[model samples]
Target chain A: MSASLPYAVHETAGHDNASMTTVGFWIYLMSDCLIFAVLFATFGVLVHSTAGGPDGKGLFELPFVLGETMLLLVSSFTFGAGMLSAQAGRKKQLLAWLAVTFVLGLAFIAMELHEFSTLIHEGAGPSKSAFLSSFFTLVGTHGLHVTCGLAWLIVMAHQVVRFGLDGIALRRLACLSLFWHFLDLIWICVFTFVYLREFL
Target chain B: MKAPLPHSGMEHAESHAHGNLKSYVVGFVLSLVLTIASFGTVMTDLVPHASRLATIVILCVVQLFVQLVYFLHMGTAKSQRQNTAIFACTSLLIVIVVAGSLWVMHNANVNMMPMSMSIQSALKHP
Candidate 1:
């Protein structure tokens, strides 16, 4: 009975190019948010359950963490700037900004891994206590996302080079944009509740 | 009525693409300053524990919001409604799980009496 729908209607209502990407990216963000939410909950429950070991007060180094946070936040901004350049079809500018974003994100992950190594060296390994375990899980999850994002950025760069401003390419860029920004959002909560709350 | 797929191509073309890179820089510097301030609070013990904690939390929250609005363009017209809804739901779920678990665990510890206490002592001693 419904075989003869208008082409425009079919294009709009069914799987149009733009909405498909937008909706898919939104769904991805939602799923990613759920994962982070789980991590946040894990951290929250165990924040005080130190299991007779050092707690946030004793373990958290705010200066180092602050530096890491800055790195991530700035990188998020740079990524947005890169997206802006992409939208404008400014290939050189986009590439430059994307490179900056990638470097900053890498730096952030390096600092975090270094901090973890130092903590483990200082006898504050995740096995030391539940608090540390949760801390590692939450922060490590974020680092992992950044690593994936860096990989995705590389792939997207290759696509941009090969395809220029094509529909599928733009959609992928949009998805990456959402993913990067969502990571920033998650970090904000981690910084406030996990690191900053020690002082509170 | 079938809605036409909102062609991102047209939107992409129409949208003014020059980013507020200057604002991003400003936000970045501000975030750095806030981070430093929080660190200072942690290291120096200059403020009372409660006050310092509150200050740091507030600063972090504010800084995060700054990052979202300035850097991420979250809550912008493009995906604001959907993004906000997702965030709100996730946040609510987080609260329920975290708070519920903490409460349940605390109560269980209290009810179980010497079990957790003994465990705590045993770990402390061993």
Candidate 2:
């Protein structure tokens, strides 16, 4: 059965190539998801093991986190707009939307860094307790992914400017859109499991 | 200066793009509503404490599917079935690992030796 196959299917090759890239990116996302799952499990296990330190109830600032969430969420939406622009072959619109998304992404990271610094200054540093340690690792990993994503966005924006809406640029933008949306998905889980669950 | 993308090849892509943009808009609005709902449920004292956890859990799951279908285009005919299959398998593995760890660790904490008991015995022996 394996030997009888023909491999000369160039008619559908473009679609196949696009789907192949998407599938590969999906696998990457799944692996990233498992890493987060491990981190979340660690947080669940140690959330109560505060080691005589402050817990989530004492440390989390809901309003600040809500602001951060809004920023990231809007950025995801903007990135989707950019993808739509790319598909429609609107180069200028694509660049404009991408620039907006990048700004929102930067703002989100700035807020996150400010929050982290405040927590550390207030003696709730990761090393101070098991709860904080798991908290930092899980949230920090997500922050790192966002940082990388910001960099990717800049590179892709540059490519779109140089290449217009070529096949390669469209494919790359689609993959990045998936990555950006995946980050939003992960953040939803983080806020639900890590932040909101604290109040519960 | 450069010629526009081929009309024939992109006809399908163009139509799909318009439909996809609508989904993105719908997804964005739905996600915002869901976020507000979760936040309101958690912050307000509307629901009893006992059921609050379950409420948020259900909300999270619902929001997850919303984003998956609308934003990620997970179930659309345009998306590849193989991608969906891989995602389903990945989700199963994640559930097993996360739930398994929490279950085992929770049981361990319940059955473990008391820190006070361990400390006192160590001091006495020394």
Candidate 3:
């Protein structure tokens, strides 16, 4: 059976270039999910302990968090559209969608950082309370990821412009797609268990 | 090596993408509205105090599933089976670690305070 194989099979056997980048990025996302899982676990364990300090009910602002959630959700959709545009080989549309995603992500981070600063200024710093510490750590870690994602988006935008729809650019875009979607996944958990859990 | 020809179903996939975008926008809007409604429930104290927390938690969980399915497309693709499995396992582990630890530690806190208070009194009078 091995001896009777077609030559075309042999020729193309070693050239399976089906984008490995997507697979690699998926693996990265799994690992990142694990990281978020660990943080979520930590927050869950400590959220109610509060060490005689203020609790989630006293500190959370549902309206502001709703705005932040909306911003990130919109950004994730725009990023998805950007990926679709790239797959359709529409470079200009892809760039425009990416720019929208980048701006929205930046806005999210800005609002988050402002919230953190205002909380600290009002004597709700992490050091003052266990609840505040876990709250900030969980939310701050996400904000940091968004900041990094925005930076990555800027770099990828330049690459897309400089190299149009080349394979490398496509790979980068695929990786960004995974990262952006992964962030959205984690935020859903955060919003549900951490922020909304307060109202419960 | 030459690039492979564009798949024969490229146009179909493009149309599918457009449809997916429309669905995603609709989902986003619904989630936003649900989130706002949940906040309103909390702010207005519409529900009885005892059940208010449970109601908000249930709403949040429902909204979370909505976002995951409509926005993230979790478990939607054959190729993503492994990814879905990993996520499910990690989530289970998280639940165990977090909820388990909270229960244990809270019980410990309740049980140990009396012992500590007795010891403090003994020491003070001695």
Q: What ranking emerges by lDDT with the best candidate at the front?
A: 2, 1, 3
Q: Count the backbone clashes (under 3 Å) in each candidate.
A: 4, 0, 1
Cα lDDT tens digits, model 1, B1-126, are 011223344332113112355655766787778767767776676878768867777877777677655554455344344555666676687667767877887787678757545565877977
| Separate DockQ for every predicted complex | 0.35, 0.43, 0.29
Query: Relative to the true structure, how large is the alpha-carbon lDDT of every model?
Result: 0.71, 0.81, 0.71
- Pairs with steric clashes in candidate 1: A12-B4, A12-B5, A199-B53, A200-B53
| Residue A50's lDDT in candidate 3 | 66
Off by over 4 Å in 1: A1-16, B1-37, B40-47, B76-79, B113-116, B120-126
Model 3, span B1-126: residue lDDT tens: 011124334332112212355556766787778777676776776776787767777776777667655655555344344555766776687667667877787787687656445544867977
**RMSD from true fold, candidate 2:** 6.5
Once fitted onto the true fold, the runs of candidate 2 whose alpha carbons sit more than 4 angstroms away are A1-15, B1-19, B76-78, B115-126
**Which residue pairs collide in model 2, if any?**
none
Error of 2 at B88 (Å): 0.5
Give per-residue lDDT, candidate 3, residue A182: 73
- lDDT for B42 (candidate 1): 66
Best by DockQ: 2
Give lDDT tens digits, candidate 3, residues A12-66: 2222232244555666776777777778777876786565567777777888888
Report the first chain's TM-score for all candidates. Answer: 0.89, 0.92, 0.89
Residues A1-200 of candidate 2: C-alpha lDDT, one tens digit per residue: 11122112223533666667777988999999999989998998899888778989999988888899899989988988887777667889999999999999999999989989999999999999898999999999999999999999999988877756677777678888889999999999999999999997
